[model samples]
Target: MKTKVQAGGVSQSPVIDIQDLSLVFKTADGPVNALHEISLTVQRGDFVSFIGPSGCGKTTLLRVIADLEQPTGGRIQVNGMSPHEARLARAYGYVFQAAALYPWRTIERNVALPLEIAGIGRDEQRRRVDQFLELVELQDFKKKFPWQLSGGMQQRASIARALCVRPELLLMDEPFGALDEIVRDHLNEQLLKLWLKTNKTIVFVTHSIPEAVFLSKRIVVMSPRPGRVIDIIDTNFPTQRTLDIRETPEFIEIAHRVREGLRSGHD
Candidate 1:
């Protein structure tokens, strides 16, 4: 069931609404504060990137939004609904650093996994699977197993699987972090195309400055050691950005700004 919380009344009803989010883990030694009082608002159809150094709470924040982890303090609402409720409704699709595709499942079956869990009809699932494969330019690899594909191809399959269910929110945590620079560049371009085509709200976490700049409409820079939002930079780049756009002065300027944000967080 969809969330009952109304939008626009409280803080404009962000696709992701995080307020004073704090996380702590009690261990044998003492309490470990993983996230500080971090707050963010991600609007519908917005592509946002979270960039921070190691030990920062980028992934933890994403997990909280995905309902995989609970915050010790603060609240998160996805589409005006609680994260856990939204997760139960399958309101978002998640792609992790690794593709995480099952070894035994073929590409099509893997793509159809969510639909199967949602109890969608076979014919509808088949159609959606085929459609998303085509969207990711992997329609021909429908029967291929995960092992049969290269890292890039496997990530593509993972993306296809994530989109097969037509989720409104896409949570990607360093999906291309494992690929080489050249392959990562290629996938970045493809991801931009897919983002435009689908118009889904994307929350991507990455360490690469250029990658984050290229893929996001806005970059959310977080501080290390009790992570918090240090800065948010908007990239007013054209929607039809290409490889040549990366070399343009505008792109360099944005990258510089992001680098500055990252540096400021450490000081």
Candidate 2:
């Protein structure tokens, strides 16, 4: 779909647009506020990270974008359409905290499952599965089951599955949070490369400062329960940056700002 530029050629319509969005959960105790007056816009092909403490509604925000959860107040649009509409159109893909791959399915089968569900022909499914497995560097493991692959590799397969659909937007919720630091670092690098190659508009939820700083063009910080955006820090880092970029002074400075934003949110 083509992006629509507004009157006077000011700015293109955002890939994801949310304004004054709020969500509340009904509980035994009464009502719990999950998000409050959250407003944000994500442009096409932008890699944006949402970082916050537990219960800060970062994932809730992502869920809103994915239409997995309904908002109680305000408005949101994905790809210039309602989240529900966008969901119906399969405009986005989601990668959850866990790999969530089925043990019964081989890596290739797992990646091909979505295509099969979408009624794509067998030949197209094979083509997409092979292409995405190679994209994630897991072509060699296509025949293996989820139980046979390493945790990191399993997550890579999950990512490949998400990409096989070729959604314009990707919503990732701490996909690497469960892995060891070393593995997480490596996956982060691979994910960065994947994002660069695919140019997907990614909204990633993470608690790791360095990961957010390293991967995002913009880092959005949120408050505790009744979450509100406390800051939206722009990194503007080059797309081709390496893991070593984390050691740079500019990166350090941005990390410090993110830390401060988190601390301020708590206060």
Candidate 3:
């Protein structure tokens, strides 16, 4: 939907807009605050990374945007609609920490399952499955089961599945976190290329400073436990940068700031 701008112009509302958002979980031990007054706006095609300690609400916040978890306070709009509506509209695709692919299904079938559920025709499903698998460079692996692929390849297949839905936004929760350092770096590069190609608004959760700096256009540093945003650092590196960019002084400086922000959050 289009939105009216104040300057005699029309514009789209941010792909994701969140204001004073907070969530609490009720447990036997009492209430646990997961997020605190979180306010953020993600523009179209931006890649934003959230980084923090283990207990922070990174995944929780992502789930909130996905409408898998409800917020207790404040407001959030995904694709200019309530998260529930946005979810029903299939406004975004989520890649969780694991591949989460079914062992019984071939890679192509796993990627095509959602389309099948959505009632897409068989020919269309094959087209989308082939298209996305090629996008993720897994076209040849389509016949193999999840158990047959390497960890990194499995994650790539999961990403292809997410992209097959053709959502405008992508919510990724450490999709490469479990891979080896070399594999993680390679996937990070591939993911960057995919983001550039798709122009999808991506909100990624990561624990690595270098990964955050390397892949993000903006990095959101968060506090521990109660999960408040401590900083939002911008990166102006070329969109086509390679891992070598991480060795540059500018990248190092950004990494330092992210590190300091995490430290301040702990205090």
Q: Each prediction's Cα RMSD?
A: 3.4, 2.6, 2.8
The Cα error of candidate 2 at residue 224, in Å, is 1.0
lDDT of 1 by residue, 1-267 (tens): 122223336534689988899999788998878789988899877999999997788999999999998999998899789999999888899999999999999999999999999999999999999998998888999898999999999999999888887788999999999999999999999999988877788999999999999999999998787788889999888898887788999999989988898898898
- Minimum summed lDDT over a 10-residue window in model 3 is located at 1-10
Kindly report which residue pairs in candidate 1 clash with one another.
none
Candidate 2 per-residue lDDT, tens place, 157-201, comes to 999998899998899999999999999999999999988787788
- lDDT, residue 65, candidate 2: 92
- By TM-score, the better pick of 1 and 2 is 2
Error of 3 at 123 (Å): 0.5
lDDT of 1: 0.90
lDDT of 3 by residue, 92-211 (tens): 899999999999999999999888877999999999999999999999999999999999999999999988889989999998999999999999999999998887889999999999
Enumerate residue pairs that collide in model 3: none
Clashing pairs in 2: none
Compared with the true structure, the alpha-carbon lDDT of candidate 3 equals: 0.92
